[model samples]
Every structure is written in C-alpha cells, then in structure tokens.
Target chain A: MTAPEVVSEDPEDTPAVLADEVEHVRKTRPRTNEDDMTLVGSVLGGLATTWLLYERVLPFSGALGFFVSWYLVFLAFYAGLTAVNRPRAVVVDRVMTSLVIAAPSVVGLALASTVVVTLSHGLPALLHVNFYTHDMSGVRPSDPYTTGGALAALVGTLIEVSIAVAIALPLGVITAIYMSEVGGRGARLVRTIIESMTALPSIVAGLFIYSVFIAHFHMPRCGFAAALALAVMGLPIMARASDVVLRVIPGGLREASYALGAGKFQTVWHVVLPTARPGLATALILGIARMVGETSPLLLTSGASSFLNWNPLHNPMNSLPLYIFNAVKSGVPRNEVRGYAAAVVLLLIVLALFLLARLVARGRNRG
Target chain B: MAGSSSLPTRTSLRVVDEVEDVPRRVVARQSTQDLAFTHGVRSVGFLTLVIVSSIGIFLGVQAKPTLQHYGWSFFTEYRWLPNLDTIGIAAAFVGTVEVAIVALAIAFPLSLLSALFVSDWAPAWMRPLLIRLIDLMAAVPGIVFGLWVLLFIQPQATHVAHWLSEYFGWIPLFKVHTDVHYPIWDQAPGFASYEGSAFIAGIAVSMMIFPMATSVMREVFSEAPAGEKEAALALGATRWAMVRTVVLPFGRSGIVGGTMLALGRALGETISVLLIISEAFKIKWNILESGTATISEVIASKYNEATPAQLSALLTAGFVLFLMTLAVNTVAASIVARSRSGAGTEL
Candidate 1:
C-alpha cells in the first residue's frame, strides 16, 4: 500500500526509499493478490505439464524423476510468468530467493528422512525387552529379535569411552592450557601439531595403536587398546575446542589476577579455568561425542566379542559402532535389523551429547 | 599476554640495568611456582608433540619394508594381488579423488546456499536454531548415514542414476556402459549396474560433510562487513545483488578453505563409502557405474584379512593417505587462518 503511494508521489525517491523500506519489509516486493495467483498458476501449470511429459509425451517414470522434472518446469514457468510483468532484476531475485529457501528445506528433509527411516526400521528391535538386558552370546542371526541384545556392545562402549575420557580429558585440557596460557615457540609448535592431528583418519589412529601396542609390544587386543585409539582421535578435537574456549575468556580477568600479584599458574587456575569452566565442559562433551561414533579406530584395536566385558584389559571387547558394522554386514536380515537398532541407540546418544554441549555453551554465553 | 604487553622491553630493562644502585632490572621476579609451572607445561606440550610425531614415525617405519620392496611402483600400480606380491594405492587413490570431487560438487552449492540463508536470510530468532540443527547434522554418525544410504537412498538413487546416464551419458563421467541405448532409456539399463556406484556414495558422503562445510562458510559469511552490505542495498541493489557484491567476495577464500577442509574429510570418510561402494581396483571415471574404492575403505576392509606383507602394504597406503590429508589440511588451515573474514572471528 505504502510502496505505490510513495512511488506515485515522489517517483525519483523510489529506489533509495524502497531500499531503506525493504529493511522493514520481509520480502523484496509486498506480495499482491496478482503475485499470489501467478505463483499458484505456475505451480499448477508446471505439475500439469510435467504429468503430460512424464506419463503421455515422455517415457520418464519414478517419483524422483517426476518431481525433479516438475521442479525444473515450475522454475521455468515462474521465470516466464514473472518476466512478462516484472523487470529482469526482480525476476532473478525472486528465483534466487526461492532457491535459497529451498536449500535449507532440502537439508531439513534429509535430516527428517534419516531419523524417520532409522526409527521406522529400528522400532521392532527396540520393542523387545531382551534387546537392552541381554548380550548376543549365543544368539545367532537366525534367532528371533527377542532372543538377544546389544548389552555386551553397550558395556564395552561404556568401558572403552570411560577410559578414553579419563585419558584424553586431562591431557587435552593440559595441551590447551599449554597452547593458550603458555604461549611461546614451543606452544606454537604444539598448536600446529594438534591442528594437523585433527586431520588424522580414525582408522590410522587405530592402526598406529595397533602397530605400537599389539604388534610391537606384544600386548593383547583388548578394550584398553581401543581406548588409546579413541583417546588419539578425541585429544586433538578436545584440545582444539578447549583452546578456542580458553582464548575467549576475557583478557581483563587474567590482567586483574596478575595485578593482584597472582602468578601465571595462579591466574590460570583461579581465574581463567574457573571463568571458562562451562566452555571446557562443552569441549569435553563434544570430544566424547566424536569418540562415541568412531568405528574404524576400534576396528583394529578392540577385537569384537559377543559377551559382556567390563574390564578394559586382557580380552577382546565390542563397542556399539563395531557391533553395528558387524551386524549390518553379517548378510543376515535379522542381524541387519539389530544393526539398525544399535545405530538408533548411537544416534540418540550422540544427539544427547550435542544437546548437552549446546546447553552448556549457551549458559557460558549468557554469563 | 595482556600483562606482557604492558611490561618493559628487554632493551628498556637493559637501560635500567645500566644504572647501578637504582633498580637494576625492570623484570618481575619469577616465583618458583611460576617457573615450575612453565617447565611442567612446556614438557607436557613437548610430550604431545612427541606423541603426535611418533604416529608419523611409526607409520613410516612400518611402511619402510613395502617401500623398499615395491619402490616407487607401489604408488603407480593399480592392482592389489598379495599372492602375486603386487599391490599399489593407485586405484584407491584415484577413486578417493573421484568420490571427493563428486561430493564437493553436490555439497558445495547446497552448503553455500544454506549458509547464505542462515547467515543473512534467516530471521534473527531462527538463526541460532538453524545453526544448532546444522551442528547436530555434523554430530550424526557416519555409519548411520551408511545405513540410511544402504537401506533408503541407494534403491531410490539408482533411478536418478539412470536418469543421469540417459540424458547426460554423452559426458564420460555420466556414461555407464550398458547394452541399452539412449532412445530406449526407459528400458532398464540394469539398475544393478547403478547400485553402489560413486554417485550414490558421493551423495552419502556429501550429506556427511555438508554440515561441516556449511558451518565454516556460514561463520565467514556472517562476518561479512555489515556496513558494506547496507551500502550496497542503499544504492538500489536487491539483497541478492548486495550479497554478490559484498558477502560472496568477502567470503571467497573462506569458501575455498572450507571446501578443501571438507574434501580432506571426504577423502578420509571410511564406513559410508566402505558400505556403499562395491570395491573395484581400477582407474575408471564412470561415476554412475557401480564400483569405487577409497584409501580408508580399503584399509578398513583389508586390514583384517591381510597377511604380514599385505599388512605392510596397507600401512604404506595409510601413510600416503595421511600425507595427502596432511597437505590438504595444512593448506586449508593456513588459508582459513589468513583470510580477512577470520581476522575478527575466533578460530
């Protein structure tokens, strides 16, 4: 309403006023009834034409093909319809707007599909009480879904991740502290090394531990070895995250501490770490998230086992990722179902960690 | 560091030292605790450096035997026949690049558009939520993506593959060798040939890396000079035009750096490709055909069944992959670090 009135009164002020006016407007144009009709007509025309091409004129078939052709046709119809009335810039802007909006919609749909497909496929396995309590010790792939569970893999995951957390958390924190608080030539070197370590493939981490621990040292293929591999994978992530967090702490806090005659270590311990506590927790949880879903690192280190194993030493243990990998590729339909079920559990756990990290980080932002 | 900036320089302190009986030095007295702390932290830092270097050293040592045996031919040879004592990373290396290229093709545009949406187009209240959702996507496990692709996407995607091969089959990459000709494209070109192809695997890996690349680009795009954006808009440019003039150019290096980082990740992605691809050891460019191999996938698959000699060969391959990713990541990190958008942003 205001756009046309303003334009009619002072036509030369149109571009500048409209540009400022657009800051308040939600869209480039205040969509009119005619614009709405064009959108609806183009869509309908696109669908009709696509149906004619796919079903009658062209031999194209399949839902994906139909939808894709329809979308392309719809875009064309829209461009043609809009070009008839609007300027070239407006037409291009409108097309780009639709495309920009469509991008996130596609991403959202992909996420929804992954969750929906995983839940739908894994629901049956979750329905069984035995799926949580019992291990797959004697349960064959031929056995019914009620007969076995991922308890062993769960136990192994808990033990391995616990050990990894114990090892990586402190080491990672120390490394971060060393880089940020103890800045020097050595700190720069360590920071560079840590940055590159983030790129180390998870499988290579497992191989490194395998070659060093089992092959060279003649150690057993056990949960402990897997924990070391997980530590290797998690440490760089943890350190890098912590370094960022530590850097974000106000420099004024450290200066105040030093002004009060506090030593470097004192400032770090009493001022810096305390100020960045929630952030450090976020980093730790994010590190754990990275470690939990890792399969390749455990593949070479922790040999798979069917029974529950609590200890990190002496014997083979199975984690959720390895269990899922083995189960899905087992070439059995029943086992494949269980694998999907395990994946659902893993996904839920990771989602939970992500939420926790977000919550903790958000709290720090507010403080 | 804040305190250090305020402290006197060594030359200034030396001038003070030259004045005897006066304050001989301006240097603050180091407490024992501070000295101990410095040493302790430095040693721990060096220990981490040692730990990291040892990985490269260990792989180097393990790869030595294979390097000595196969010489430079190890990288050039495409076949892996342990029995014949002929193994090389050429096929897997090419496949890795092919898969990474395809993933970049799909992921880059989506990430860019979505990143632009999140940074500039999204409502203020919705921005954080969208960012969190992208982060959550990153948090989703790769193996789950493998399962999704295997059970849900692969069957559906084969048709899309057929569509590509039908229309765009003139392009060598889209060309899949099948008896069915172009005119009878509606007739099955054997969807079996399309299953587990590089196209499908790339789609799977693209989903995995999309979040990672988006976050980087979004971070940089959001940091584009707001004043310039408004100036462009005030000069009668549309929002898209403003973005093109200001944000895209500002974030150009960020896009390259982020995409390269994602490419490094795509090259290292193991489980999804391992599941989706049917292993074929040849240098083929037909992405629509049903066979591909990546270095990480080959390592995971062959490590279990490999003999001692074959194990050395696998380690040698791992070394190459490590070096490849290392180089990419180093260059990417340097670019990201040096980019103007990153100057005011936290790393």
Candidate 2:
C-alpha cells in the first residue's frame, strides 16, 4: 500500500505516446484521508443491533448461537447504513467488507467459546489431584468426582498412541518418499488410494480392526487392538500429508543431488527427505492429532478398564477419550464433572500440538 | 560380466596385437546400493496400496451377507430390530441425509463469507493469524465437539425447537411433537419429548465442518486472478462486484468441491452424533424431534452389542456409509485437482 511518487510527462513527447504512458498508473488508488462516515456509521449501528439481540432481546443458545444471530443482525445493519449514502456498487462493496469482518468474529468466537467452556466445566475436577493421579478401579461412578483421576486413561492413551505412531511413522514417511521420488504408475495409484483413505471414518476403522483382529481372531481387548485401529487411521493421513509436503520440494534439489552421482534412492533419502523434514514433522503431528482424540475407534477396539494397564498387549486398557466418553455417559454429576476435566486436558494437548505443528511447518517456510 | 572378464581368451591374438590398446571389457556404472535402495522404497510404496485394498475388501466381505440376504430391503425397511430377525438402516440413511442437508444449508453461506473474510477483509497483520485459527479449528476433536454441544447447546435449543413446532406446524420440517410413544423390545423408542434432536446434532456438525469449508473457500478466493480483479475494480466496479464477476466464477468448482468434502465428513461423523441423537428407528420428518439415528451413530452404538446377523447388518451400513463418502471425496478430489492444475491459467 506504499504510494509511488507522481512523475510528470515529458514535455516534448507526442500526445498519443504520453496518453499511452499514463496507463502505467496503479490499478488501485490509496484511500484519501477524508473521514469515512459509512464505516463509522456501520460500526456504530452494527454494535447497537448486536447488543440489542445478544444482551437484551434474544435468549441466545450459548456463545455460538448468540454470535451467529448477532452477526446476522450486524450484516443487516451495516448494509442498511451503506445503502443510504453509497451507490449500488459501493453498497455491495461495503456489505462484503463488513461480512468479511463478521465471518471471522463468529468463527473466532465459537472456537474461543469451545475452549473456554471446556476449561470452565473441567476446572473443578482438575482442582483435585486424584483426578489426575488415581484410577477409577475402586472409585464408584456415583462417588464424589474427586475420588479418582484419569491416570490410567492417560497412561493407556500414551501407550496405544505410541504404538500407533511407531507403526505409522516409518511406513507413512517412506511411502511419501516413494511417491515423490519414484515416478511411476504405482506411486500414482498409491497416492490416489491414500487420498481416498483420508476420508475413511474413525468408527469404520475401529469396526475393521474389531472384526478382523478382535472378533474373528479372538484377540484380547488390549491397547494393541486399539493401536492397530489407530494405526490404520493414522497411516493414510500421514502419508497423504507427507506426500503434499514432499511435492512442494524444489526440483533443483533433486537434480543437484543427481549431479553429485547420488543414486535415485540416495537422493530421496539424504536430500529430498532432509529438505522436507520440518514439513514431514508437521504431517506427523497432524496425523497424530487426528488419531489422539478419536473416541469411537478406541471405544470398540480397546475395552475400557478402570485399573492401569501398562502393557498394551496384556489386558484391556482405558484411554483419555474413552474415559471421557464413559464418564460423560454415566450421568452422575461427579463423573460428568470428571469427563469435562478430561476434555479440558485433551483440548490443551490437541491445541498445543496444533500450534507446534503450525510453527514447525512454518519455520522452514519462513526461510 | 565380472567372472567372464578374468577368463577372456586371446582367440584373435594376431589381430588383437594390432588392436592391443582396445579394452577387453566394459563396466556398468550402476551400484548395488542404488538397486537395493530404490527397490526398498518401491516396496514400501506398494505396501500402501495393499493396506488400502485390504480395508475395502474386508469391509465388503463382512457386509456381503446382509447385502445378499436382504437384497434391496436393506435400503427400504425402517426398523433396526435385529432380535426378531429384522434389521434395516432406512432410518439411519434418512437421518444422515437430513442432518447433512441442514448442516450444509446452515454452513455454506457462513463458510463462504468467512473464506472471503480471511482472504480479503482481514488486515495484513491479522491474515496469517486468522488462517492459522481456522486450521486450528480443524484440529478440535470430534469428541470435544460432542461434549461442547451436549452440555451447552442441547438444553437451550430444546426451547427453540418447541417454539418452532408450536408456531410453524404448517411447515413439515419445523413441525415438532411434545410427545410420542413407540415401545420396542420393552424400551421406549420414540422420544420427541426429550432434549436430543437432529437439529442440535446438525449444529454441532456444522461447527466441526465450518473450518474446512471456510479454508477451502478462502483458498479459492485467494486465487482469484489478481489482474482480472484489478480490471474489474478499475472499471468502477465495487469490491463486491469485482469478487462476484471475477472471484466467484473462477472458484465455482472449488466451492462445490469443498462443500462436497465437508458433506462427506459430516455424513460419516460418529462421536458427536452418537452423543447427541436420541437413537430412534423411524425416519422422522422434523429435525427438531428427539430421536433420530445416523448411520455412523448406529455403527458406534451397535458394534459391541449386536448379534451375528445384526453385526453383519451394521457392517453393511458402515459399508454403505463408506462407499458414499468415498464417492463424494473422489469426485471432490478430482474436481479440486483439476481446478488446481488450471488455476494459474485463468489469470
């Protein structure tokens, strides 16, 4: 938006040439310093309407509904203000501009509210260390919510998710390398299938593992079964995300490695992959994030247990998400309170991972 | 080539003596390491292909019986009673479609606007932050979404549903009931009197889906040909006119593709709906009704408890849901791929 200085036309130039030269002017002009009554009025009016609807008039459904209804009112009010002084086209422009602002507010508010509400409800349970440290084995659901913690569930989630990551990471990243470095019909087919698998539902993934590994084979309802299901969900997502990261690698890096007499596989391994490491990490984070909070898959594959089960293969294990699901459904106030607290912890973890993933993904790009 | 070089004989010794300087053998430059490395990578790639196929095959095999036994009745019959030798997912089919419709109806315009907001209206310093926030929204887990809605939305939305039913009974969709009784297997199945409803579930789903739709639309809007947009604005067209004439048309395919992908996700979503829906069998007209089951919810609820035949039925339902999402994503992916390839050309 920096303004360029005006240059006078050459005095000796012909009119036709001079007129053609003027076409080099900037397409969009900077707004003058004049007062913008339209914006001022729109802001004032939009707020008035929003306050009336959200604060005084409507019994809004929590923050999301309030914001949505408030936004609708804001949009109407802004457009009406602009319509009076502005031409038809300007009105449209103003309205769209206001809407752009409104959209973000609504989305932002909903996200903020989700986190806030979770934390508020979860705070009371978090106040009790037992909620974090104790298992629910001896504590009844009807007992005071402070009686037990999600320690068993937390340990179980780590064990299972670790197993899933162990399985998915190598296979997923290598597959991505294959897709990006080895150009062939097989790679293309793999890419397409991976893309399709990205949409495979979490519940279906659980069902698949449940039927094959648990029911048919009569395998134990342990963390391993859950891990297998989670691995299934994680692999395609990681592979696809890694593939996208690998595709953006500069072609010259590959050629440069080739010129140094590195083989195709060596070029992929030492060069292409190293260049895409940060993005690959992001991909891994994204894949893991998607799987970590998955309740339905774990619900079916890993039978819930109140006692801590360290070994994923030995016995049934509980996960944080499943624990949350169980506690929520128990309909006891304390259990419900415990569920909300677990949810808050889960949210914090997911949010942190999401932020770290973005930072890692962006760090290299910033270069 | 290695062993034969050492055993070479001078059969043409006299002729070879004149051409003595000529080399006896040629060596290929390729190394053993290179061969081993690429082959390993290639195998890993193909393993991906195997894993994908097995899922499809296994699910299909599991679902085969119910599909074969019931034939087309699986899609037409309404009740989900498996104990009396009857299991049908017609209600789930309708409920999924119904909720998805409502979600899309609510989500599309809002998402479209948010996309534009991030792309156009956001201040320069705020754009990156806004985009990151949108992406963060996608990371919120489905279970969390359920928790949010179950606690915060359900209680409040019931009044709205009741009022809508009371005033707008003329409209079939808005028509709600205060009470309904349908006892099945000694359990009260019909539950219009309660808090759980498709409308609330749809809202939760829409929240989950909003980020994706907005980000997609944002990407589309961001790619609108800069030169064309400048031209439109230079012609005294307003910002809205410029966007309408240049951006909207250019991103038409992107919008459709994005919405379809969101719909695909919404249809297969499990935890949120499972936590919210009242889990009834009949296909209800009013989204405000308490008991309505989606295909995904059905699978999650019945996976452990179902009988052998019922398990197969659930698998068939899951298969049907899988096929639907697969079809939707494939179409959307292809459209998105095609549009991406041709994106630069439009400018």
- Candidate of highest lDDT: 1
Q: Global lDDT for candidate 2?
A: 0.80
lDDT of each: 0.86, 0.80
Tens digits of per-residue lDDT for model 1, A255-301: 77887878888988899898889979977897798789888889899
Question: Model 1, B36: alpha-carbon shift in Å?
Answer: 2.1
lDDT per residue as tens, model 1, B1-347: 43455444444333445547444456776689888988897887788778877888888888999999999889999988888888988999999988888999989999999999998889999999999898889888899999999999888887788878878989998988884344554345565678888888998899989998999899889989899999998898887888888999999888998998999898888988998899999888999998878899899888877877888888889898988889999998888877752211222
Instruction: In angstroms, give how far residue A67 of model 2 lies from its true place.
Output: 7.3
Q: Which stretches of candidate 1 lie over 4 Å from their true place?
A: A1-30, B2-5, B8-25, B181-189, B340-347
| Candidates, DockQ | 0.49, 0.36
- In CAPRI terms, model 2 is classed as acceptable
Q: For residue B266, what is the lDDT in candidate 2? A: 90
lDDT of 1 at A151: 92
Kindly give the stretch of ten consecutive residues in candidate 2 chain B with the minimal lDDT sum: B1-10
Screening candidate 2 with a backbone cut-off below 3 angstroms (N, C-alpha, C), the clashing residue pairs are: A131-A149
Q: Name the docking class for model 1.
A: medium
